[model samples]
Target: MNTVGVRGYSLELRTRIVALVLGGASPGEAAKHFSVHVDTVKSYLKRHHQNTLHIVAKPTGRRRTVMALHEQQLLAQLETHQDATLQEHADMLETITGLKISYKTVDRVFRRYKITHKKNTGRQRTP
Candidate 1:
């Protein structure tokens, strides 16, 4: 049997799998319907049943700070002025918004936006 790519599976496929499992459809039947292996269907059912026991919500990956559009514009300005240090950026943001943000926070935002401290030249330098 060919291994199914999880990325290629859609929401509809997930719903179908859940419905088939809950409706007491055999693993083989469910697998045929989903175009996956019988073992895959059984595994999904087992996982679904296990998850239903505890029902605790899973924690999402790191959340980003919610910055306003104007704040983003200010960030752009800071990026253009590469000479400005992290402390300077933080101070400027605080002065404008009356919200004191740490230099680390400013640095993280810069990294997330791919705005490096040093601008890259088109020419590549050899070692």
Candidate 2:
């Protein structure tokens, strides 16, 4: 997920790499020509052979919850109704967004932001 130093190989370059390798060029020769690793060229060739190169950027993890869009509203609501129970907060969110929601979803949002309980006065994170 950290793509800091990773310069992704584009489709044009990948095709060229694969094509060079398939056209009587060694993987190493194609890699050197493209300034990429031999394994990268080999992987391109493998995907080409498997007819899977067209697949691009498939999602990697669980889809974000519907509650994601109402994060700020939930936080502000919690700020005023800190004593409210999770189910009450969930109902409040439902009313705010007109969406069917559960206490578990609210709890997940709270957990994601490290939202504190009633005991903690500095409950909200300092942005």
Candidate 3:
């Protein structure tokens, strides 16, 4: 889901907003004090009444990854084949782990570990 500007409120903040409303403050007043939407304050009040005032856990967004399960094996393979390109590394990983993974995934893993895929070339002289 696209959540560019959307965000979840903290449990403490929600509870405070609800408390404000319960303590004779209007929903709009609570919203203004908390700098949140009036609808948010209303929702908090509703949740308080329903006794379901809790913080929602965020989605992890972790899909299946070949490298995550076989980091040691992939590291061993890389140690044995330092000159292998990204595609070659991906193919070798697939063959060893029987998990389908793309070269881009391999590149992402390398980047995450701060490992450079490109070889160092001598400095170019400016004419």
Per-residue accuracy of model 3 over 11-70 as CA lDDT, tens digit each: 888899998899999998988898888888898888888888895756667865754666
After superposition, which runs of candidate 1 have C-alpha atoms over 4 Å from their true positions? 1-11, 16-43, 47-63, 79-81, 119-127
- Write the candidate numbers in order of decreasing TM-score: 3, 2, 1
In candidate 1, the residue pairs with backbone N, CA or C atoms under 3 Å apart (3 or more residues apart, or in different chains) clash, namely none
- Which has the better TM-score: candidate 1, or candidate 3? 3
Error of 2 at 69 (Å): 4.8
RMSD each, Å: 7.1, 5.8, 5.8
Candidate 3 backbone clash number: 0
Tens digits of lDDT, candidate 1, 6-111: 3434546655786787899888888888788777677666757776422433455665553765359557757576577778888877777776878788877778
Range of the 10 consecutive residues with the lowest summed lDDT in candidate 1: 118-127
Question: Which lDDT values do the candidates have, in the order given?
Answer: 0.67, 0.78, 0.77
**What are the runs in model 2 whose C-alpha is more than 4 Å off?**
1-45, 60-62, 67-69, 118-127
Give TM per candidate: 0.46, 0.52, 0.63
